[model samples]
Each structure stands twice: as structure tokens, then as C-alpha cells.
Target: MRDALRRLSQGEAHPFDVSTGWDVVWEHARYPQKAVLGLAAGRLAERPLGPYDFKAGECRRILTRLGFAPVPKRSGGQESDDADDAAEADLRQRTGLGPTEKASLIRARRGQGIFRQNLERVEKRCRITGLRDRIHLRASHIKPWRSCSDHEKLDGNNGLLLSPHADHLLDRGFISFEDSGALLIADALDTRVLDQWRISQPRNASAFRAAQCKYLSYHREHIFLGRED
Candidate 1:
């Protein structure tokens, strides 16, 4: 599989098709097969595959092993951050923030400050779960921070207060919300995993603002899986 991947990287014609190669890699490769396929596909195609093809976790692992860093997948139809190290260096210099400060800013940007305050005003509890405790709730961005524009980044309507489990599922694209606030579960997600997480299909949807509806449309088109339409 590695040899096939290497040959594929070099633009050489290979006898094995992508699916056949994937099967061999999935069966025998020590590394995650999706990562191997993602790397090969990304290299050859010069573009990152969607989460449905190579999940965020697998892509991160693949890039890390190849001496590259990972950044958030963009939501506005932009490409992945190919120059991750340069982008990080530029961020550090531009912001004059140390590692700890940068980490703090990231957390704040994702779920604190005016964003969280506004979300709290509109939503008193988790949208999917009934958990109301502030300690257990997170202000998750509908359009992720790294993907958001400056205005969208702090837009109150673009956020949701969700319990940790729901937040995880949403962030990783295992689930998403329609513009009308219906829950969307990825087809690729295992039922066993959902059962283990004690998550059920949410029947009651949250109320969405006009702006939130726009952001949710983007999520459905770019982030959510299962629907090809």
C-alpha cells in the first residue's frame, strides 16, 4: 500500500485502483487507512477531501505524521490551510500572543466573551439536551472559529449552547443542524457509537434566527454528511 501510495504521489500510473489500494491498506497498514488514503488523495488531487471522505481526526494524524500541522477546515468553500506553519508563525507575530495566551484566545473565541453572553441570553440550555448547567454547557460556533470571518466569528446568532457530547458531535461533523433547526446525523457514524454515547435522534429542534439560518445552511452544505443533494 505504501509503495502504491508512493507511486501515486509521483504521478506514475499504477495498476491498482484507489478502492483496491484502500482495501490493502485498511487490512495490513499499521497506520490508519483513511489517513493514508487522504494523504494520497490530497497530494494527487491537490485538495483536501471532505470530512465524509477523510475525517478531521484522520486528516490531522496524517498531516502530523508527514511533518505538517493541521488547521480547521474552512466553511466558505475555501481550501484547507496548506501552509499551516507559516500561518501559525504569522498569527503569533501578528497577535504578539504567547502559546498560553493563544490557547486562551482560542477558547474564548470558541465559547466565551460576548459570544457566550449573547448565546446565554437567547438560549438558557443545551439545544439537543436539556442540560442547563452553565458548567456543562459550551458555546459552540455554528461556523467554526478558524473558518469564520471577523464578523461571523463574534456573531451571536452563529453560536449554540450545547452539552459537551452534542458539541463534540457537531464540531466533528458527525451531526449538524438544518436551517430550520432539524438535527442531521451523518450516515457514516456508527449506531453503536451513538448508543454508547447515549445519544438519540433529537425530536425537538432549537429556534433559529435569520442569521443563524444562513450559517446553518452553510453547515448543511459543507459540513454535514449523508445527503448528497
Candidate 2:
């Protein structure tokens, strides 16, 4: 790195001793290393030190100034996201899906884009409050995006257009639905809030399609919190 800097600044390559380079590499590997490289580099700067001089930081600062960000150590959540991305890519490869189709699937994961459009086909409004305005409603997954297969993620029958509060409740296992479309209120939910949300007591969403009912069954089993007597 130092030799490269010299060549770039002075237009003459520094003679590199391979034996010395190997010796330094071995010393770094075996000995307790100290962070003196930057100070040493700064002292040996080819030109006078300036405000933006990366000679003080062993070129890391200059690299950043040139838009070359140093790679950070990945945390557990970052690693998980990377693994999920790899799995999604593998799925796309196996299914022969192009970038556009893969992108659609990714958007569907958040119940936006294709997923919202699909839900609009089957459900026109929020099931709980009967809110018809699309802009105010959320297309939420019955089996949830994280728990579902790729096909299930975009399944129209696996979703509902819910108000924000309703979606939050459903997602957090505070509410669910029966195949008969009867609302299943979790014990943890404060019943008083239902009135504020303009939801009636002993309400039923009427009935679900067979496909929707299939997904509802999964939601009731897994997401519906606090069983009845």
C-alpha cells in the first residue's frame, strides 16, 4: 500500500523486498499487533500533511473520500437478511423467474404492489370496520410473509384488506377469523376499543371463499391469541 502511494504521488514505483513483506506478514500473524501503522504512514507522508490527508489514517480516510466504504462486520440480523436474500435468489433461479418477477415477489412480502392489487380483487374493504377506502387500508397476510412459502406470500386468498389498527391487531395475534367469517377476539384485546373502532359486538365478516377459508384456518390456529373456554 505504501509503495503504491509512492508510485501514485512521485511517478516511480518503490522497490519492494519480498522477504521483508513476508517477515512483516508473519509478525502481524504471530505477535500482539498495535495500531501504529497509521502514525508511521503519516510520519512518512510523501507530501506535507493537509486537512484531508489520509496519510494520518493509513489511506482509510482517502478511500472513504473516493467513495470506497470499508466493509463493516455483519451482525446477526444482517446475516439473516443476507441468508434470506440468498434463499429468495435460489427460489427465483429454480422457478425460472426474471428480475421483474422476483421484484414483484419482494414487494408482495410487505403486502404492497402486486399483493395489494391481488387482495383488492377479492376484498374491497376492511373486514372489521367495513372501510372502503383503499388508501386507508392495509393488505395484510393471513399466514404472514415470514412464515409462508413464496407462492403463499402472493396468494390473494391468503390476505385481507384491513384498517391499520385491525392489521396491527391481526399481525400481533390479538385477533383472527373463522372459516364462517366470525371474528375471533383474543383475550388480550381490550373489548372497549372495538366500539371506538366502530366494530359491533358479536360480528361476523359473513363468509370466506374456500381458498380464503383455508388460509383463515392457519391464522386462527397460529396467530389467534388466547383461546376461549
Candidate 3:
């Protein structure tokens, strides 16, 4: 493997057909894996690094593009920190918030400040686990705060108190709730995770008020990935 990459990078001849793109008609409407490969098929998916055939070319290409070809100075240099810097800069322009105000507001978005206090008053425990401890729970927005208006961002009715694991599932669209409060599991989610996490996928533990249901409706319609059963 090492020799092949070295030879390839040095423009030396190699005996590896690692640059063939196979047309993989899989992964579907949910994940969109069509037009996947091929240097020049009936249709080519020009994805930057796929020229090296599907067998091994893609892997080699990714290793180099990710800047993992190996550096003399930094043995394992990390990826850039620019993502957060860019996101924060964008946030400042959108919200017109100075550094101090934006800092606390960002904290509130991650479950702190008045938003969390209001959520605590309405939701006493993690919905999925029934865990009453606040320390182990996170204040999760039903309609994500990132896409919300300021009014919705802070609305207690727009949030839920969820355990960290449950928050992850919901945030990533692995699960959601119907307006009637029934659990809606995503087709892509591994059912084994429910057992491992000890999640029961409860139904109607407590009724959501009309206002809360309003936001949950958006969750089911848009955020819920798709049905499993």
C-alpha cells in the first residue's frame, strides 16, 4: 500500500487499477448514491477524486485530498479550525450581535441561559428516558434554533428536554415525534441502537399542547427522515 501510493505520487508506473468508477445505483432517495462512479460512463459523477477506479483509486485519492499524505514536521497534523471561525463570523452578521452578547447567545443555543430555564419549567424530564436529572439532559430545539427567528429560538414551547443520546438521534433526523406524540423512527436508524441506549421509543408519555404540537408538526413533516415501520 505504502509503495503503491509513493510510486503514484512520484509519477512512477504502478500496477493498480484504483481509478475505475463503478456506477453504483444504490443508497437511494434518502441518501442519493446514484451516478456514483465512472471516469466516462453513460453518465459520469465528476466528484473531484473518483478517477482512480472504485477498487482502490478512490481510497488513495481521499487520503491525499484530506491532507494525510504525511508531513515531515507535524506527525499527525489536525484538520483546520476555520469551520467554527467562519460560522461565528456569519452569525455576527446575521444577528448584529457584538462579541459579548453573541458569546452568551451561542451558549444559550447549546442549552444555557433563559431558553434552558424556560424549557425546564415546561419539561421536567428527558422525554425518551424519563430521566428527571437536568445535568444529564440537554435543552434541544424541536425546530432547530439555527433556522428559527429570534422569537422561535427562545420559545419554551419550541424546545424539549432530552438526554444527550436522544438529542443526537432527534437532531440528526434518526427519530422524531408525530403531532399525536407517537414515535417516528427513521428507516436508516439501526434498531439495535434503541436497545443499546435503553430507549423505549415511548408513545404519548404526556400530551403536547397545541402550541408545542405546532412545532412538532414541522419536525415530523420536514425533519423526520422517513418511516421504518
Candidate 4:
């Protein structure tokens, strides 16, 4: 499996008889290990090969290295319900706006049109993956929208253009950045999961302006998990 991955990284031909080389790796592994690797490889096979494919490939390598068992999946509906409840509670505490007003405000301030254009002025690419394509990037809030003041909702400094995956990590507080742009991973997150997701900690991001740094400070204080002085 290692040899195959090495060859793939070097731009060499597929090292196995079948295209699903990960299946071969899984077959050679022990009980629980097989299930984890098999799942990772299966995801890789689902996506078309491209520069974006690097993350999925790296996931397989990380899974192999860590040798951790797969985590149990949670129900989508239950998770969504919990998230909705949290968002509602946060909105009530921060904004004190009614549901209709909140919905309107969210629509107006949500990252699109002017907000997106403003983000482009500050960030040319994803800070993590360095992906420059506009289509593949999102203008994610540094301080979450539901928790922001009216002024902050539209502030360019309070936003970042991140790849969808990076945005997911940031929004969920699985990762954050320092004022100096160094990546910070939550202690609660499994190292293997971080590796599989290609989330590198202690990595510097693209340069941040002073205003962005202030907003980032808020994120570190309020959003980042396991934050320390």
C-alpha cells in the first residue's frame, strides 16, 4: 500500500492489478483495520482524480499510519436537530431578533454578492489548500453570522475565503487560526481524523491584516475548542 501511494504521488502508473488498489491493501490488513481503510479507499474511488484528490489520498495514508478503528456514525436528522437548536439559542442570546427578522438579516448578510466581493479583496485563495478558483471557495465568517453585531455582519475583516472542507472545520470549531495565521486544531479532535482530512495544525495561513487579526482573536476566544491563554 505504501509503495502504491508513493508511486501515485510520483506520477507513476497504478501499482496494482486493479484500479481499486485500496481493496488489496484492505485484504492484507487485520479485522478492524480493514473496515477503516476500506471506507477511506471507497471514498477515494468515488471522487474523480484531480488536484483536489490529494486530500482523499492523504486520508488513506493517515488511516494506515494511525491504525485506529472507525468511529460510529450518528443519525443525520438528530445531528441536524441539535445544530438547529444550538443556532437558535445562539441567535437569541446574541441578536435577540425574532425568527423572521433573523432570517432576513441572515439572508442580507450571508456571504454572497457584496460580502463575497469584499472577501475577494482580502483573500485571493483558500488559506489552507491554496485553491484559487472562485467556484471552489466560500466566504466564511470568522465570527459566526448568528453571533455577530449588525456592523460586524458585513465587515470584510470578519470573513475568509476558505475551501468547503476548511470552512467546515472552521465553522464547527474543529480548527482555527492565530493572529499570526498559524493553524490550531482542537484537542478533542482525533489526530488520525485530522490527518485523514488533510488538516495540518501549526501551519501558517496567508497573511492577515490587522482588522482580520482582531476578528480572528474573537474566533480564538469564542469559537476555537480547547483554547488556552
* lDDT by candidate, in order shown: 0.59, 0.61, 0.57, 0.59
Q: Which pairs, if any, clash in model 4?
A: none
**What is the lDDT, from 0 to 100, of the residue 172 in candidate 1?**
64
Off by over 4 Å in 4: 1-105, 227-229
Model 1, range 155-194, lDDT digits (tens) per residue?
7787888888888777666678766667777655677877
Alpha-carbon error at 32 in model 1, in Å? 17
lDDT of 4 by residue, 7-93 (tens): 344555431221111222323332222333434454568843332233323434466356642221222225433554676566656
Candidate 3 per-residue lDDT, tens place, 75-145, comes to 11121124334544667776566776666556657778777988888889987888898898999989866
Best by the TM-score measure: 3
Whole-structure CA lDDT of model 2: 0.61
Clash count (model 3, backbone only): 9
- TM-score of each model, paired residue for residue: 0.57, 0.57, 0.59, 0.54
Q: How displaced is residue 70 in candidate 2, in Å?
A: 47
